[model samples]
Structures are given as structure tokens and as C-alpha cells.
Target: MKKNIWLDGLRSVARMGETAVVAAKAGIKYATEKPSNAKLMRETFESLGSTYIKLGQFIASTPSLFPREYVEEFQGCLDQTPSLPFSYVEEVLASEFAGRDLTEIFASIEEKPLASASIAQVHAAKLVSGEDVVIKVQKPGVETILYTDLNVLHWATKILEKAVPKVKFASLADIVEEIKTRMVREVDFIEEAKNLEDFREYLQLTNNQAATAPRVYHQYSTRRVLTMQRLYGVPLTDFEIVKQYSKDPSQVLITAMNTWFGSLMMCNSFHADLHAGNLMLLEDGRVGFIDFGIVGQLNPEVWSACIAFMDSLQKTDYQAMAENMLKMGATSKQIDTQVLAQDIERLFSGVLMADPQELLASKPSDLNDIMMDMVAVGERHGIRFPRDFALLFKQMLYFDRFMRVLAPYTDIYADQRLQMQMDPSLLLKH
Candidate 1:
């Protein structure tokens, strides 16, 4: 045990030294070329590997806390990662199922990965029972690298904040801590399996037949290997294929939105990352929600505040929106609701007045810009939203983008199908 600890310590030191060299080179290049800071940071994160790649994705999703350019730049950080060799993947599977026979557990697992990301690679497999599935296997040494990289990142954020006080607005240290908590949970396949199961249960209980999450095979799953029911489908972003699957793609968006909104109230946690890749149009015309790695849990008070905020937005009640925003966030000092209302009204009125067609043209980024503007204004009033709130808001923005593509020129706020109000009975049951 002591020798293992010593080896780990040595590895951590080596990783830190390597990171420092890479960062120094990137910094010198940035200083000389005067390229956009967002581009430079994105490149640096990509070069640094898993932990930074995940961080970049977080930044991309979190428009509520990051600047528009940074958020836009990091959007490229989705799942663009190099794959590990089949031998390494086989080694991980053997280690994860040490005593069990691989042939007994899985009839066959494809040598080539179906997909590869920072932490894991997925392979198409068939079980002994003749069921098709996918096995998500964690890469060797990823946890150690994650720990070392996050420690270095946390340290760097502290130093940067101390050097530049202006960068302290969104609280970089708190964000890093939040990332650490989520990423740590992400590496644990057990928790992700639970998330998938819970979501599946929520769908069953609600009789939501239009949308589904991948069914987890708990018997074959472990901390490092997750075996789930294979969902064959094209991505939701593949509009041509989606149109072929569903006659009215607009209804697909509606079904997805309603199902997701129901989960917010019914499930223990909500899917925080609902990018185009995570959502798919299945072979049977059902909307498939996959990738339960990152999720958000909101307390009752925050959830109530969120519902109220959405209700207020539908009604254009800026005062109510401001009050709910205060309820949803934390601050050391009190803020004036009236002033906050004025600021929100001023920011949103222009967005609300824009032609729907033009808004649809911009789609995702337009809504992101509006949310960022609101965050900027809220920051001025000393209102800092919780991480959960930001996650929820980001998902909402994603839905808004989908709406533009599926139901062009539709007003999401006033849509009759959208249940903006939370059901009191559902709240009590939860």
C-alpha cells in the first residue's frame, strides 16, 4: 500500500510538471499572437486531455456564468477524443470483472469502440441472453489523471483570482469545486446507472411512451464498466433522418420538452447535459435520452423558485421574475427587487420584441446570449445563482434551440403544450 501511494505521488508530480510546461508554452504563444483568449484556452484544454476536456464542456454548457465567446468556443469540446487500443479496453474489462469469465458475461464485444470520450470508451456488445447492449469502459489511469489535473486546476484558479480580482465575479474556486464534485460522480458508473434507472422509472410512472432513457443492465455493471441496453438511432441534430423517422419533427420536440419537464419534478435528478448527441430519434420513433454522466439535483426551494421564474417570464412579469431570481440564488448582501426588475425588463424586452424568424435564424446562440445578458445584469445586483440553477437554465436554452429547428417561429413561452406551471400534487408526492 505504501509503495502504491509513493508511486501515485511520483505520478502526480510528473503530471504537474508536464502540465506546467504545456501551459507555459500556450501562454507564450497567446501573448505573442494576440489570438482570442477563448480560442487559446480551448486549445490549451484540448491539449491537456480528460479533465480539461470535461471542464471545457462545462464552460460550453454554462452560458449563465461564462462569457459568450468562451462558451461558444468551448462548444467544440463535445466528444472529440482519440480512442484507446482494443488491448487496453480488454485489459480494463478484465480488471473490472476480475473473477468473472468474459465469455460468460458477454457473448461478444466489438473490438472497435462505438464511441470514445475523455474518460471512457463505449463498445457494442451482446449478452449471453442474446440481448444487444453497450459497455462503457473507463480508461486506465484516468482517475489518477483526473485527481492530479483537478488539483492543479484548482490551484491555478486560486492564483489567477488573487492576481486578477475582476475575474472573481463568477467565483472560479466555487465553480472548480462544483466541477470536481460532478466529475468525481461522473467516473462512478454505479451512480450513472442509478440515474438511468431513475429516469426510466420516471418515464414508466408517468406513462411517457414518447421518450425513453437507456435501460441499464445492473447485473453486468461495475464502478468502471457500465453495460446498458443499446439504443440505435440517429442524433436529434440529424434533421433529415429525424424527419424520416417522425412525420412531424415539431411534435418530437414537444414530446421531449414535456418529458424532460416532468422529470424535473418527478425524478431525483435531472439530466444536466442534453446536447444534440445525448438526444436521439430511435428506430421505433421514440426519443432516446442517453448519457447520464452529469445530472443536477435542485432542492425544493430552488425548484419552486425556478417554476415561479418561468411562470413570470411567460407573463412578462419582471418583478415576479426578479423576486424568484433572488429566491433561487445566494448572496451575502440584500438586493433591491424593483431595481432588479427594471434591469431584467430592459434586457428581455428587446429579446421578446425581436422577430421570431430572426430569432430562429440565430437559434441556440440567441437564447444563450439572452441568458448571459440576464446573468450579467443579475451580477450587477449582487445575485449569484446556484450551480444547479445554471445547469437547469442551460438545458432550457437547449430546448429553446430545438424548438427553433422543430417548430420555427413558435413562441415557447406561450405554447399551449408546455406545462410551465408545476403541479402541486406532483410536488407533494415528490
Candidate 2:
């Protein structure tokens, strides 16, 4: 044990030294460059690689935490890294399945990847048993690099906390913690497989057939590798193609929204990533939910109050919305419900209820504005919204955008078809 501890201590020092070198290089770029702070920061993050890219994404999504310019610039934090060689993939597979002949496991795996992101790459493959599958293989040294960067950031946050007086970085230790939690989970294929399995079970229990997630192949899955049934479909964002597959595209979007909303109440976790690529309209008329890496869980207070909040919104009850928003979050001081209601009224009165054509014709994504306004309101009221709430709320905004494009004129909140969770018992019964 003493030897192991000594080795670990030496390794930690080496990792920190590596981090300082990278930081120094980033500093030189910052000093020499004349780009805006946000743009330069994003460029530095991209140059530093995976952890910072993911951090950039977090900043993009959680606009409530970062400055407006930073949030807007980070929105373009793309993670389309060049795919590692097929030989590198074979090495990882061999290391994972030491004694097993990969030939016996997979009949064929395409050398070229269908998609390659920072942490992992997906390759189309066929099992020896003739099952079509997609293998998500984690890149080499990803976890190591992730840990080194996070450790450096965590200690930096701590050092800043002591060195600076009420500096913004001192307040940002929580962001580091949040990033650690998320990035750790993202690198764990086992957890993502469980997320998919749990959602599959949720579908079975609820007797729902309109939506489905890819089946996880646990026998072929490990901490670093995930194998799932291959799902073929066009993205839901492609309305033209979606219409070709389904008679009514609006109904498909509605089904997708309802299925996702149902999962919030009935499932262990909800799909937190809101992107066009992750949601698809399968050829057989099912909505395919893919990429279960980032999932969200609401605490009991938020769960119960969020339902009421949705219900109140459907009824246009601003007072109830204001009260329930408070319940969904926390505050150390009292807030006037009437004033909060008026603030919300000003924000949501016609924004969410805008004409379908008007919403569709808008040039920019208004969801960011809506999110910022909501966060600004929360700040004013001293109601610190949960990170999970930001996630779920962003998802709702994505659905709202889908509604505007695919099913405009339909108020998703007021639509009876949407199981907006007015009754918690309905979830339990399912």
C-alpha cells in the first residue's frame, strides 16, 4: 500500500505538471491573439481538446451560468474530430477482449466510422450471429486526459477562491464539480447502456409503442465499449424526409414530445441532450431515441412541482406558475408571488403562444432568449434553478421548436394528447 500510494503521488504531480504546460501554451496564445475574449477562450478550449470542448458545450447549453457572449460563441464548439485509424480501434478491442478472437465476435466491422466525436467513434458492424449493430469505441487516453484536465481545473478553482476576493471564478467551483459528474458519466459506457435499458423497460411497462431506443448488447458491452442495435432513420429535423415516412409529420413530432415527457415521470432518467441528430423518425413510424449519454434526474421537489408548473402553464395561470417555479427551485428569502407572476406574464404571454408562421419565420433561435429571460427572472427572485431544470427546460424548448416547424398551430402544453403530468398517480399506474 505504501508503494502504491507513492506511485500515485508521483503520477499526480506529473499530471499537474502536464496541465501547467498546456495552460502556459494557452496563455501565450491569449497574449498574442486579438480575438474577443469569448472567441479566444473557445479557440483555446478547442486547441486543448476533449475536456475543454465538452466544457465549451456545457457553457453553450447552460447559458444561465456564463456571460451572453461566451454562451453564444461556445454554441459553435464542434466536436467532429478526425477518426482514429482502424488499427487503433483493433488495439482497443483486443485489449478489451484479451483472449477472444474478434473475428468470432463480429463478422464484419466497417473500417470507416459513421460518426466520430471527441470521446468515442461509432462504426457500423455485423455480429457473427447476423445481428446488425453499431459499436461505440472510446478513444485511447480519453479518460486519462479528462481526469488530468479536470483535476487542474478543480485545483485552479480552489486556488482562485483563496487568491481572489469574490471573483466570478470563486463562484464557479460548482461548474467544475458539475462538469466532473457529467464527464465521468459520459466516459462510462456501462452507465449509458443502463440508461438505454431502463428506458426500454419504461416503454414496456407503459405499453407505449410510438417511441423506442436502441437495444443494448450487454454481452459485447464494457466500461469503454458499447454495442447497440443499429437504428436506421432520418433525423426528425428533416421535415421533408420525415413526411415521406409518416403520413402526418406533426403527429410524429407530437408522439416524440409526449413519449419524452412521459419518460420524465415514469423512467429513471430523461434524455437530456437536445439535438436534431439524436432524435429520428424511423421508417416504420417509430420515433427512435438515440445516444443515451447525458440523462437528467429531477429531485422530488422539482418533480412534483414541475408537473404542477406545466399544468398551470397550460391553464395560463401565471400565479400558479410563479408559485410552482419557486417550489421547483430554492431560495433563502421570500418572493412576492404577484410580482413574479407579472414578470412571467410579461415573458411568456405571447412569446410561447406566438402564431405558428411567425415562429417558423424567425431568423434566430429564440430558445436562447427565452432561457436567458427565464434565468434572469430566477436571478431576480433569488430562486436558484437546479441544473436539471435547465436541462429539462432546454429539452422543452427544443420540442417547442419542433412543434413550430413540424406541428405549428398546436400548443403542445395545451394539447390534450400531451401527457403533461398533472397527475403523478398516472405515472405510478404505468
Candidate 3:
């Protein structure tokens, strides 16, 4: 009952603040001789707090599903806001550990954060035993804010859907459910610890050294606190630094691609979020993966269908591609495979004939043109791709974009270029 009272009071305050914000936004738009809408939105979201920032990050990550304007605008919302103070950090640590002081276990901790996202901020530290580590502390009251915001957002979405009929197909409630599942998982650092350990085991079993995930110190970790081995490197998006390590950036890309692709087949879950920020090129010449907040798993049937879809794309077998896509996606009715094949072939014939490098350019117009074509094809076939498939497809599109910046000449599908660093014994046999 107390919790309900607190939540109700929070919602009332939020609604009042939201009304003021909306009014201010309206006035800003009306008087706009020069208006930076993105900046305004970012400031408003920051004022609104954690939930909006988290949603902004989601929009930035999901390119295929959102508008170009929104995607480009939200890219600036990568948690540049000020982090909670050291006092708050100490409080979180104390709360999680129950009366234990941070200095008791760690010889030193740098209050300056390495990275600060919506949910948590990471700090570099050293254990008393002399191990260099990074501590991730969940900001106080973030979960409460998230729950409150989610509830309010759900109500707003329902209201918006009622007013706008076109969005009825993509139910707002479903999107909220998906985001809630992922966000709740993110607040629990213990789950991230497990994900890191499982990924480490996967790498060991595969004998892959092209990339490295952080090592978790489970003893000191909790739902709100995490201690991991600190990694030093450049973000993978830094082409200039990546070129310093390898003469052929194309090979570096191929290794990164194959390493991640192999995990989909060999591991229980695959990293769903592989944006450039989450990937790093370490000084030791290894890829560093950080942030395991969102992941994807596939049943065997879906996995088989995905493999078949890839094989078909490689073969340029449109009929097989259509079949695999149908099997992989959800459909309300049986569709004609032959017609779908014809539609896909027509859409991609010109595209497939072009140099892959040309297609990889992330020019907004170029990407929009292709996406519009896919929607057209979907309309013709009476088939809608599932959100999971769209998520994977968008990741591939970003991979293509990265290839343009990191490696121009690489053939992503060519056999000589497509080598998996994990289990190179197969390479020796070939």
C-alpha cells in the first residue's frame, strides 16, 4: 500500500512536469526561426530522467524500425549527461554490500567514470589483491523511476494508438513489453556476470582469440554492483587506430564478423546489441565486447531457417530465400513462395549487381531507398518480417556501414575473406 502511494505520487508529479514540457516544446516549435529539435528533445529527456534516456538509447540502436530523423537525432543521446556523484556511488556500494566499505576490498577506486549509461556508470578500480578492475554501479532509484515511467508511457501509448489508427498494427503495448523485459534484465548485474562467464566459456570452447569479453568478479558483484577486469582499447569505429594494428583492415573486419557469427551457432545466446560503441579494438590486438544488456536466443527451427536464409542469399536462390524467410517469420496466412521469390528478385536484381562497397555506403537516401523497396515487397507478398528478424537485419546493415568505414575492399561472403578465428584448425584442414 505504501509502495502504491509512492508510485501514485510519482506519477502525478511526472504528469505535471510532462504537461509543462509539452507546452514548452509547442512554443519552441511555433517560434522557431532557428530551432534544434534534437537538442531540445535531449534536454527534455534528461530532465524526464532515466527512462527517457534509456528509450533514446534504444532508438539509436534500432535503425531499421525507426525514422531516419529520429535515429540520427537520438545518436547524440549516448549518455553524455552528468553521472551521479561519488557519494551516490558509495551509497549504492554500501547498500549492495551491507555496511562494507569500498576501500576495505579495493586498494583504490577512480571516481571518474569510464562510461556512464542510463542504468549504471562504470568506474576503474584495483582490488586489494592487486587485480585491476572496473566497478559498475546502478544509480539509486533508477529502477523505481523506470517502473513509474514505463507505466506512464504505457498509458500514453494507448492514448496515442487510439488517436492514430495507422499504428494499430505495431501495437505500442507489445513494444513496451519488449523494452521492459530487456531493461529489467539490464538492472541486474548478476545476469550480466553470468552472460560474461558463458561468453568466456564459449570463446574457450571455440578457441577464438579475435575478441575478448570482460572477466566478472562474482564474489563482489550483486544486482546493483559489478566488478570486472578493466579493458584498455579504442572503439572499433576508430578506423585510424584499427589501421595501425592491421595492414588489412578488411581482415580485421572479417575476423570480427566471423567471430560474432560463429557465436550464434555455438552459443546459447548471441549479443543483440553490437553497436560500434559496445565493440572495442584493444591495445593487445583483440576485440573487446562490453555491455551485455540485450541478447537474443533462437530455437533450433528458427536457427535452421536462419542458416538456410543465409545459404540462399549466398547462392542467390530467391525461391529458397523466400521459403526460409517465411519459415523464420510469423505469418497469418499461407503465402505463395513463387510470387514472393519474384518480388524479392525484382527488388534486389539491380542491387545485387552493384559492387558490395557501393551498397555499404550509409548515405541516408541510399538506405531509405532500399528500406522503402523492402516495405513495398512486403506489401505485395502480404508478409511482415518479425521484429527479431528486423533487429538482426538492422545489425547486418550497421555491419555493412562499418565495413565501408573500416574496410572498403573486403568481400563479406567470399570464402578466402570469410575466415573464423575461432577453431582455425578447420582452416588448416581446408
* Candidate numbers sorted by lDDT from highest down: 1, 2, 3
359-413 in candidate 1: lDDT tens per residue? 3344566766766787778889888776677688778878866776677766665
lDDT winner between candidates 2 and 3: 2
Number of the candidate with higher lDDT, 1 or 2:
1
Give the Å error, residue 262, model 3: 1.3
Highest TM-score model number: 1
- How much is the lDDT of residue 155 in candidate 2? 83
Q: Give the 10-residue window scoring lowest on summed lDDT in candidate 1.
A: 354-363
All candidates: TM-score = 0.89, 0.88, 0.82
Give the alpha carbon lDDT tens digit for every residue of 5-110 in model 2: 6756666677667656777877787789766889888887887778999999888877667888898899789888899999988888987888999999999999
Residue 334 of model 3 has an lDDT of 73
Candidate of highest lDDT: 1
Candidate 2: misplaced stretches above 4 Å? 1-33, 300-304, 307-316, 345-364, 408-414
Please tell me which model should have the higher TM-score, number 1 or number 2: 1
lDDT of 2 at 290: 94
Worst 10 residues of 2 by lDDT: 354-363
